[model samples]
Target: MAGTRRIVVIGAGGAGLAAALEAGRAGADVLLLEAAEQVGGATARAGGVVYASDTPVQKARGVQDSVDELINYYMTVSRHELEPRLLRASAEGTRQVIGWLEDLGITWNPDRLYIAGLEHKPRGHMPTGDTRGLGPAGGAMIVAALLTAVERADNVEIRTGTRCTSLLTGEDQVVVGVRTETGEEIPADAVILATGGFGAGTEMLRKYWPDAVRHGDWHWYLGPDTNIGDGVRMGLAAGGELRGRGGTLLETPNFGRLNDAFTPPWLIYVNKHGHRFVDETDTYCVMPHLIGRQPEGRCWAVFDDAALQKVADGGYVDPYGLGVDLESNWTAAMLRRQIEAGVVTSGATLAELAARTGIAAAGLEATAEQWNADVAGGRDTVFEKQGTLAPVSTAPFYAVELRPAIIGITFAGLRIDHEARVLDTAGRPIPGLFAGGEVVGGLDADVYAGGGTSIGNALVFGRTAARTATGGAA
Candidate 1:
């Protein structure tokens, strides 16, 4: 009891759970705290893809990816702004961390390869049988496995609905523990801040990430309700530096929760003036970046009955909206439900659809005519859209307005070092203070690589933080 070290993990998401498991397994007394009623934060709601280099799945499938390639891709995509040391650690340790998950009884689905925003290769590793519905099934599977492992660990204590309101620091401003909302104090030898970014915090978005909040009142969050920058606030109060607090991972936007579901490939995106912008088949990261350049961060998805029926006929759009045979993340049934809810408007004619969606009828009709011609000619003359072009002539026509929204974790939080230690404004590590996941920023810059990047960061750094906190091999 006297020699036992206490490790406190805040936010019981992927990072917190992984950190608690590793620390507890390493003979430390671990306390995993969550503000929610259960674990599985944004990770459960995510696509469940963890981008890793040199994974066993990659080897078995002959993926031919190397850490150098991964870093090159990361640097290229992130504009060489990602911290070099953190990037190297993540690239080198991803395969081993994935092995750790495998050793914990987590199974991989080797059938599918996801290459959304991740460039050049298929580095996404997912759990077996994780595809169930629109939500990420692999993420739920991973969380369930981690929860079971944590439950069986005698050294780990999980306390849900206990929000860490503040960080407690000792002499020299070294973090000692955390204080909960009800003024409950939980002391620890080391604290791991796994609490996610500020996607839901309007004030925090306004104060720190103004670009994320600049798009009128239309911008919204697709992350969990718990991601209100709790870790960022606590870290800032404890004098930790913030980084990458400018941009986020978003999509073609939505009207309230109308278009919050996955984007379909065949659906046409047009701006207010009813002109197609960007190739629809562009990657997820590219789509949002393209959409953000449009006037007022606005766009609209126009689809016809034929496109809808194509989905009804078993053709599927993958998680990143690429055409595939797998289940459509946004199903036809969901579309019908949205239609019934009036979030998606349908019309018997193009002009009627324009009237319903507030777009000019003349421009809408012209756009539809060009789209039909493009589909018939087997090429898009305007945007040069990839894949087989589909005509939107079949009625009734449907339209859904798009407003820029955060579809993933916010890209700003407490800054940390290569060892996962929270750093101060002076760039010095705060002793006994560490962070991981979305809470520890600088892994990304203006652009998001994809879904797996966030998951990979959480798993790799969460494990690293735990080992470092325990004074074990990192």
Candidate 2:
């Protein structure tokens, strides 16, 4: 008895679920394997935004945009370090995926559409769905929709609590299936590796991303503990090559690992010498990078008693409420707790504060004077920070050392083409092999594109890989 095309999609995250649903809908038998007790991977913890352009969502919001414009912004922000062809694929695929996801019970509110990147356009399409307390709101909403669709699809079989240890190869160096840790081998006509980034893997971080290790013991990953570079390791053993570098690092005061990427704008950031280095309210995509370039590869956040009082008065939380909640580390309540515990350094004067925090006293005094002057004059002279400028002249000055140590997305992974087919060292696509999500590399450059670009890449390449492996039916 001949069966339908059997495809195995590994790692049941957004990318894996997308691949499984697409392949099953396209008439292929799909075996979706997940190592964790649950699906969703890191996508489940994201803010649930998909970056796109020139879609009905944008049109409904009365924002006119084009694929060309979107790619140009992406290239410009990445300093032209990305592959134009790959960016084109991502731009086009994400725009269409918005509609595809809509058909699967997800909703996009025109009012929720906002600018998510450094770009000057509104390309961040936020999906409206219920995570049912599963994970992060927006991303969990997306993963839930895809998971429901996959569950309803008759041809897709989901296997949880199963960890794939290696790849099964046949003659001609073609991948056939995956070998589980239990020595179980399930053969398939094709395999798509969707296991996510290596941010949580210690050895992988040491070898591939030392920038993360530079923070030493303070470094920690936000993704699930299961994202240990499984897909990349299996792909490498199967003759696939690696590409790309760097990852997303969010600045944190080590506030109990709550995934706080955005900070309140009421505080100003200064380097080791007590010099303002960047706009205090700059986007997180570039905030860590800017801080990394400072002396000692770190910075301190300075605030006056007034701002701390504002926090206590229930203000200064992340205005955007990034990643599904209004709470942040910048809350005055949290600050007071740390302050009482001596984690936050305080001084009665600028010179005293600088001395306590090891900052140059003269530089700190001069910078505070300039900041106060700029705020009074209603203009930021140096960085032109656009946030509400509160004078730092209030008594009991404070400084808290902040480091970009919370690892979010690891960018280095398996090399894949625009169609999501895994490529070997010689730049040839391996037969019956594909990948998606953070598992595929070369999509990011020196700086992260934006907030939603990661989840966008996951869904786009997941569907792309399934469609390619299923002969374009997906």
Candidate 3:
């Protein structure tokens, strides 16, 4: 006990669990703290994909990819706004973390590898098999596996329902311990902040990203409510600086607050000017950005009575094959019900539809005419939409307003170096203070790079922070 290093990890999410496990395995005493009663944070409610390259899974699947290539794609998507050193660490660490997680009973089926980003190569590695009744499979499965491993580590102790209020710094402003809301102080050799993003914090949203709350009542968060910028507040008080901005905002119809991510492929999304903005089948990562660039940042799902009538009742359009069927208001019965309730706007013609939905009439008419021609010709020349092309020709047209208001992940927080050490305003590492996950930013730009990058960064930096905090090599 006298010679061993004691590390206190706040927020028992993916990053915190990985840090606790890594430190505990390295013969360091770890105290994993969680504000919520449960252990998992946003990681548990995610899609559970880990984006990595040059891994055995990709190799086994006959996909030759490299970390350099992945970094290049990331930088290109982020417009070179991300730190190269941290990106290199993330790309490299996540590659090895695949094997590490596999060693901990998480299986990566080479067959499940898919393209999760803009890259042509497949780098998104999804876990195979059931989650053993641990909530929904993806992120829940990953969380359950990490939690089980952490529980088995003898040097690791978990304390939930404990909220850290502030940091205790000794001479030279080095973090010595954390003070809980109840006035209890837990001293440690190093403190790891992994409280995730601040999507649920309205004040932080107004201060950091006002656009996140532009729609007010229509805007919603898809993460845990505890992600309210506590880590950012404490880190700022501890002389830490913030980095990065914006986050992933999925397009939502706000129909009964359903958790569905994708809509039926047959529906076309048009901007307020009645112009199709992007491919109807693009990933959720950049859909919001594309929509945000439109006039007034308003989007609508346009369809005809024919397509609505042909809608099946069983399952909505899920091209991703992620098995995420929480709720769907797209069924024919539901559509008719919403249309009857005036929730789904309808009109007898394109002009009437545009007038009712506030879309430009000429643009809507042109788009419908081109769409009908594309459908008849069996090709979509405009957006090259890969989904089923349903002609917008019927007695009545329908339009369901869509908004990119569902906040998924925030990208701004404390600044950290490549080794996962929190940095001050002068870019110097804060001694005895490490941070990971969404709490540490500068890893992304305005647009999200990939789907699994968040979870991947959590595991990569979490382990790296533990290794560095324990005075060991990563």
Candidate 3 ranges with C-alpha deviation above 4 Å: 129-134, 315-320
CA displacement after TM-score superposition, residue 391 of candidate 2 (Å): 1.3
Evaluate model 1: give its lDDT.
0.78
lDDT (tens digit, per residue) of candidate 1 on 381-420: 8977666467989999998876556546677888888789
Model 2, CA-based lDDT: 0.88
- lDDT (10s digit) by residue, model 2, range 4-98: 89999999989999999999988998999999999989998887889899899999989999999989988998788778988999999999999
Superposed Cα RMSD, model 2:
1.8
Output the TM-score of candidate 2: 0.96
lDDT of 3 by residue, 10-87 (tens): 999899999999999999999999998888889888778999999999999899899999899989998888889989
lDDT of model 3 at position 292: 85
Number of backbone collisions per candidate:
2, 2, 0
What are the models' TM-scores?
0.88, 0.96, 0.96
The candidate that achieves the highest lDDT relative to the unseen native structure = 2
Least accurate 10 contiguous residues by lDDT in model 3: 315-324
